[model samples]
Target: MSIPAALRRRTPRGTPATGRGLRLPVSACVVAAVLLAVVLVPLLVPLDEQAVDMTNKLHAPSLAHPFGTDDVGRDVLLRCVYGLRVSLLVGVVAALTATVIGTAVGAAAGAVGGRTDRMVMRAVDVFSSVPHLLLGIFIVAMFRPGVWPVVISVGLTHWLSTARIVRAELLSLRSRDFVDAAVSGGASRWRVGVRHLLPGVLPQAGLAAVLMVPHAIWHESALSFLGLGLPTHRASLGNMIQDARGTLLAGDWWPTLFPGLFLIVPTLAIASLAGVWRERINPRRRSELML
Candidate 1:
């Protein structure tokens, strides 16, 4: 049977079919692998930094130590894996917290749509005016360095963008036929907003949450690097990188290199997945890509 050319999807010039087809799966696998490692690695492998052997400090990468040894003889590979666990934990928790807060605030403001909306949006703008890292630094500085503090700081600082996205989505959805029909059918603003609007925003909220993960991870890493995040006793990508400062300058690169790769790879994979998701959700973009 002959198919219509209009319905046929065409690849962009110079793009490899195999690469395009595999992009999503590869990104999914990378994300899943990182998540699995974060969850299961601790149970399967022991990472005891205190059990360090000074004799092996700053060793280069070898079969016995894939990522080499850190300044204290702790296994770089092990620490990187453990650090990944901490980063992922903070990122996921903070992103979820931000999502919840943002969704609630945005939904309320968008549904009410009056002085209430103006006030809420003004507040969002005020918060957005401050650099997130600076605000995060200020917030974390007030408390002792720990995972929870970083999570709170990151979550509080990151919610503004999500709130804006959610609010815009709600406002757009407000004008839709279903929403108008519900309103015409004697639905109160509260009922219409909650029953009709909230559910409609969940998918966008979810994608926002997913995309926030990498940003949260970087924020936590920045805090840790500045000695304001998780304690030194814990493994963290930022702490690891910070600790490797001297070693990196002294000609040993693996200490800094490996942890960085761990950080960069997972974030990139997540971002790729998020991009795919965004395209899927946007009808115009989806159609453009198809044509």
Candidate 2:
């Protein structure tokens, strides 16, 4: 039973072809759906932050209030939705800020080399020596407790790892045949770095960015929990849990439990997606996963 060449050429690599691209894994798909819901549902349903109903205070999960009410009687479910918004915003912004700083520093160090590289690497070492959380707390303490401070704190503290990754990647890429050809063809150092080296380094940097999101989220939560994140009146997962500390001993678990779950689930989902993306992007790992 010899197959015709045309049929063999048309056949898919790993599965029956239905003229569609490979589908995402079940876990990745589930995570993507959850993330989409978390980001979108809150926009569709508005809730009041200042509308306190003391009559419903400390209520447990029920049909009317699926996540129950907080001490001041704001709908816990709505607060959770709003909290998700703040967490996602902080995570996304912080990760982006870190990535930009890292990319610039790493690209410059790797491209310039010599004195620039040494100084940059030394700076990275100094930053890396400090514990990220402690550094974040100190930075927030120095400035006002708000969204930008937390974002800046997390961004400033977290870029060291990304810088190192990009620097290593660029160092390797700089010596490649194509880059050498571009240099030999009269392209300026800046052009070669931006056009060739930068693009080559972006994939690794992007993966680093994806991985940074969870860390940023956790950092934001930690800051918020310590009352140094968003304003106390603003809804945030960290502050929601902070509010529950006094009530936990009195058997009021829903207040803390729901927000904690909200925080953990999204972080896990994002991390899971990053893992899947990494596996898919790496040829060896993609092959292994397929097998």
Candidate 3:
């Protein structure tokens, strides 16, 4: 009379995250926790950026001042925590936008063959000819450097690579026997794309996105370094770097270094986990799963 737990998707035995699974593996859990900490510790800690202690200016890492104070005495730790939030925000937003646009374009190119495909791909080819970081700079240049501008700029520049991958996968997938069978079974083109093909290629798109995040974070920081970044109040890792540049000549590494390290950890974690995430997306992987 007691209800049993629902079986996992195609799981043969273990359920990795469900307590019945592999317990997330020690390394995976640690990495995931580290990524979570990058988002959390800064928010939980109560450090003020504007609270100035001129007496303690340029303090080195010590028992009291772990990350040390900046030239004006702002907590490097607080600024880094705040900067992580902003940098991660921009990266996630921009990547999602690109994913959406790329999915549409790539799916269309695959679904609609002949001249439409040729024209769309030609446009894709054009974007490919331009270097992404240079294009990111130019796009950010066109608009005033702010949160939305960075988000939109980076998102637009990123879709080229995604669109190409999507096209390749969709083209090959649309011709599969199952797809033709679905079409012959009276499914609409949209249905075929959405129900079958879209789901098939979406994992690859996600993988592309996860892989792209580190590069995106780096670019965001680089653009900020170049003064084409967010306002200082916004607290992106790049802005933090900008703030620290003046003090760097005198060797204030703590201010710039710690935020940068936090910025990097998520990018690397997500990138490294991309393969796992992609595999999770595959139906075949479900069959291969042990509980």
Candidate 4:
């Protein structure tokens, strides 16, 4: 229902505490935690994330190979298990880059006002007017193939919407009371902006970061699907899906199905996380936001 009551902070007298207003979505909690676990364990446990075993090809799901094997005999479970690392890594890096660039540009536009805001927003509008995939393709075409290329290209292309969002939020905050108080207290523009305004900006940025993960995941996969992404040796989700695309009609269901399913999990995770954020922000209105 409304931001689960179980998370409500209570005192011995059964009154709500200072933390009472904050809430977390249970589904997001499980999904985010599971994703983190999947990414970390393989790295720490010494299971070679990229070690290929030719003899194990095409084995169906069993005690040993849970998800099954691919056409080349690599353990599908191991690949999926490790593939989360690659996908999440790309998603995290690209999204952070986008957020940082967006935040800086947006902050300056909101803080300076007048010609600066107009110029920055006009630039954002120009970029946003173009198709994201088209820009991504051009970026990929410009660079030689690699993982960083995907990160940089996606990062650059995806920042406009976030920049606009940050700009709008900062605009709203610019005239607020504490902002005025900080200014009246003789705080420098940078200090007041960073200390007072930026703290308020974080919730949106956090939500943006989580929401951006799915976008990054889908973008990377689409790029690889279009043949403009990570090279074979890297073993990204995109490359996995690209490998599976050829086998889809050949009755090689494992290759296609497994990668697709893995991609869906994170998309679902982010959607759920976004929902939780909505609920936590507006407990009574969570259902409206959910749909």
Identify the leading candidate in terms of TM-score: 1
lDDT of 4 by residue, 1-291 (tens): 676777643342343544323323555565777577676777666666566778876677778767777767776766776666667778889999998898888878887899989998998888899999999999989898877888998899888877887888888888789889988999998898789888877778777877888899888878877778877755677778777676667776877777788888767767666755744664344443354
> On a 0 to 1 TM-score scale, where does candidate 4 land against the true structure?
0.80
- What does candidate 1 score on TM? 0.91
Off by over 4 Å in 2: 1-42, 286-291
**Model 3 alpha-carbon miss at residue 284, Å:** 9.4
Candidate 1 residues 120-205, lDDT tens each? 99999998998889998999989988999999999988888888999999999999999989988999978987799888798899
Supply the TM-score for candidate 3. 0.81
TM-score of each: 0.91, 0.85, 0.81, 0.80
Backbone clashes in model 3, listed as residue pairs = 13-290, 13-291, 14-290, 14-291, 15-21
Question: What are the per-residue Cα lDDT tens digits for candidate 3 across 48-148?
Answer: 66578898988888877888888777777766766766677788888888888987888788778889999999999988899887888888888877988
lDDT of each: 0.89, 0.85, 0.77, 0.76
Off by over 4 Å in 4: 1-33, 44-56, 184-188, 282-291
